[model samples]
Target: MIRIVLIGLWICAVALGTLFFTVKSHMPASGDAGEKASYLGGIDYATTDVFSVPIMTDGSVAGYIIAQLIYTVDIKMKARITVPLEYFVKDEIFRQFYGSYSDTKQVEKVDFERVRKSAIDGINRHFPEPVVRDLLVEQFTFMPSSEIREMNMKSIGKRLSEH
Candidate 1:
């Protein structure tokens, strides 16, 4: 009975060690291929939300903020932008811009032309030279005003916490 118990314990230890090693070996390192793919100016995948403010005729600004999400499947490949949010709010726009829509397609050329120039202008202000080859919006929808307010609240909370 004692011998059997000892053998069981030994088996468990070996199994655990093997499992740990396997998981560690498969883990991605900072300098690995996956990390390399995430760097800017390289062929990497990134998804981020962008906000645009549209000026209304009455001197009051309304947000035509679009949540721009993109994914690069291959290097130097034309990635798809999925617009998941497109809504006109009185003041601000806040919502998850991706994964909320069923459609996944590129933004129309006319729409792209309008937004791209604005985006380029915005980027140029911060960056000395433009880095983006093209800008595309995959999916677009509307976000509620309440959502934008909530996001503002959250930002305020964060700032308060930092101090």
Candidate 2:
């Protein structure tokens, strides 16, 4: 009876030890998840925003900019945005910023300085409570109208040749 009880307890101990080791090995290490890994290692997100700025033809501003004619021109653009994992963690501010930026019609270009200032101001204003270590802009491309047409033509030619 003593031998059996000792063997049973020994088995239980071994089992518990194995289970603990397995769980600990499988669990993520501290700061080893998601954007933390990328940010810490200096690996930037692969994302971009592409847009066009219509140049002023003649002296008159484009109809889209009649009232809003500031130092900057209106640009039609397509953005390839990567939502950082950190941003997703911010429920309220993230939702507001996401909603505001989702509209293609609302996209416009201001002076680069103005844009920079506004972005800095926004970060200062909203991110005070939360600890965000880094926000990175991975890429920005300006797609001209001519380049679009040329790319379309090349794509079409390639398709025709393939067929």
Candidate 3:
């Protein structure tokens, strides 16, 4: 019985090897459809313009956080990936940022990936398919209300001084 099993295994291996070589020889070349093929399946990614989201605390914009995100989706869904989606993405990132650290003052110091999964899920809601391969926080700045006011005041002052 052992000898018979060994012979059968050897024959199966040889057959598979022969089939592989035959198929390989007849297959199309690598570059034949390179242009038409997508590196990441058939999905293309869209990037959102830099946008800021309000970090709410007690029904107010406790802090402002800005982020640029990237997503992979079908081209047909480009329109859906617009302002609404941008707002959602920003909200998601803010939720993660705020939940992890209540105070936005430590936004830069807080670790983002801790809430990465949730943030990614929040962003992926726009796409029916889970095409969000990853979420990248290209730019993240967490500024407290005071700083924003100060910046605004400075800009106003600069304009007034110039005039």
Candidate 4:
């Protein structure tokens, strides 16, 4: 009876060890997990803060364009950029919108494809290599100056009434 009990305990230990080893072998290594963390292994996204630009028409302020953008760059290439990408993005957006005013004055018909291509090209031109992969519009909107003034007035009125 004592020998049988000892043999049964040994068999249980062996089975547990085999199960542990099997699970361990099937599990991903630490290095593999790290690689998976960066699913886009080579590409990374850089997002810009919300910014606004005044659209000029006939040498005066027409309205304002508010925008926020996200751009993609190769993770390796991003390290090579010395200046913040926001500068390029904002400049491109301004140039595109402001420049269009001279041609048509109406931004409603703006071609998004052209803007995307232009932004990518414009940013790439400043770099030694084309580091900017693509541009994505997170927010692109136009608010007339009158609408802004009206909104501000309403806000002020509400605040005064609360007091």
How many clashes in each candidate? 10, 0, 0, 0
lDDT of 3 by residue, 2-80 (tens): 9999999999999999999999997656787565555434566667788776777766678777667775555545545
Q: Considering lDDT, where higher is better, how would the candidates rank from best to worst?
A: 4, 3, 1, 2
lDDT of each: 0.46, 0.41, 0.68, 0.83
Clashing pairs in 1: 81-138, 82-138, 82-139, 83-138, 83-139, 83-140, 85-141, 86-141, 86-142, 87-142
Worst 10 residues of 4 by lDDT: 99-108
Clashing pairs in 4: none
Per-candidate TM-scores read 0.31, 0.33, 0.57, 0.72
Model 1: lDDT equals 0.46
Model 4: lDDT equals 0.83
lDDT of 2 by residue, 1-163 (tens): 9999999999999999999999999766776585665454542332222222332324432212111111111111002223433333233223323334322233344243544345434543443232333333333233334566788999999999999
Model 4 scores a TM of 0.72
**CA shift of 1, model 2, Å:** 12
Return the top candidate by lDDT: 4
> Across residues 25-143, which tens digit of lDDT does each residue of candidate 1 receive?
87767565665546544545444555543323234333233555443322343233232112211111232222222322221212546555455444334333333444455655443
Top TM-score model: 4
| Best-to-worst TM-score order | 4, 3, 2, 1
TM-score of 3: 0.57
